[model samples]
Target: MIAPELLSGLPSTEELPCSDDTPVDNEDQNSLPNLLLFMLASLWAERMDWYFGVDMAIYHTTGEDPRIPVVPDAFLSLGVERRKGGRSRRSYATWEENGVVPTLVLEMVSHKPGGEYGAKQEIYRQLGVLYYVIYNPEFWQRDRHQPFEVYRLVDGQYQQVFSTAEADHPYWFPEVGLGLGFRQQRLGGIEQEILVWYDAQGNPYPTPDEVQLQLRQRQQELDAERQRAESERQRAESERQRAESERQRAESERQRAEQLAQYLRSLGFDPDQLPEQ
Candidate 1:
């Protein structure tokens, strides 16, 4: 129902609303990798100077009803603004975006039938995607046992990347400045999870949440250091003032004694008021 209307009206990237941003549902804990890929795709896309729309699904043109929408695990749209007005979008409606769909599509194989691997691949190919990625860590095995594979459209056919290739991290594409690879990290105390990023050659890109946490910690340290310096300065000023006051008091006493001695001498009284023992 909503699909057909959207299909007929894909908007320009500049005119797109960030509120179109949709909240991803946590269908399973295993879906964590999917979330990481979606965000990393958007970030690397921005760094590479291309604008891409990620996630969400729309009616597949070949067979599915034009009025229905299908949500993808993650997808990438090239030629879109990497960051649109400094905000992420909710959903990607193709009709509103120049009729151009993702250049790359990735699916975390959970439970899609032959229809998905076959019809879905064809839909994306027909939609002009250049590459399709599948991570079947626990599902289908082509070489008898492997978790991931990338297929590049060569002459209108899918060419799978063998398990023994240099396509690992810093997975290079001439189009994007960054590389895509699987790495280990701690998330919610979970370790060694797969992540995507730009090539450090080995350096890591900071997650949005992690960046914010670091900023907060640095600010706290700065605040404490400033307060300490202020206290030390105030203490030093007070001690100087006390020392000056004591010197003045001692000078005043000395002057008073001299004046008394002169008065006694002028009156023919003993200059010393009390005789020394």
Candidate 2:
């Protein structure tokens, strides 16, 4: 907490810039976070307890200066208004938020290393962030780390997590009730490798387009089943009609035989004995 004297001296979030203005080195840095945001928006559209930001400044008094911020490529905070006070936030100020820090922070490694493995990790640790994710897709070889890494704050230190290759690689967060992983998915009408959310069972939550496609496919299947059922009903009805027709024909033949027998008996000629035809 900032001392009373220092609290008044701190600059408001509105006074700070939302980003550092350093140009993003690659498109993935921007697009990947957006993909996550898009998926979250679709998945949690009705919920107002979470906020996700991309390239946004997060100001806190834990640092030497409250006005200065550590801008993450993307960050998520639970138990915060989806909009700050029903308005978009210019920046996230911990003091204004009842000291609610970000639940997770992420950095996408660009052409140049951004100290994700060293300095940023420490900074996030000091900031009390629960989870830190470094996505170094292209520069993993140079950094001597995997393309994706998730670190959890354990005992005031960041601990790297490892998982076997047999299962789908996703770091599940029981606190958030979701998982983070990579998948080949299309976004903004372009197919590419992207980050996606998963469930506790390692099943990915489908994107909006995927959900729509599934709904359409399910409707088609239902229509086909209905058609098949109708065809079977028609076949059964036809069989019933044919059986009825045969029954009527037999009845008519029996009645005709009886009538001929009666006429033959009136003539004193036994029809049963005289019949060679």
Best by TM-score: 2
Over 1-277, each residue of candidate 2 has an lDDT whose tens digit, in order, gives 5556766777777888887778888988887898789889988999999999998888987677777788899999999999988999988888877778999998998898888888878888999999998877677888788878889999999998742222247789888889998766776688777788899999998877788888999999999999999999999999999999999999999999999999999999988799686
lDDT of 1 by residue, 1-277 (tens): 1366655453443444433244443342235445555556546643544544335554334345433444556666676665444565555555545555667676665643333367667776665567777655445553243455677777878777533222244344445455455555655456644646555474556655455677898898898888898888889888988988998999899889889988888888887656778
lDDT of candidates 1 onward, in order: 0.57, 0.85
- Clashing residue pairs in all predictions, respectively, total 13, 0
For model 1 the local lDDT of residue 197 reads 57
Judging by lDDT against the true structure, name the best candidate.
2
- After superposition, candidate 1 runs with Cα above 4 Å error: 1-55, 60-70, 81-95, 111-119, 140-145, 161-170, 189-194, 245-277
On the 0 to 100 scale, the lDDT of residue 144 in model 2 is 84
C-alpha positional error of residue 59 in candidate 1 after TM-score superposition, expressed in Å = 3.9
TM-score (all chains, Cα) for each model: 0.62, 0.76
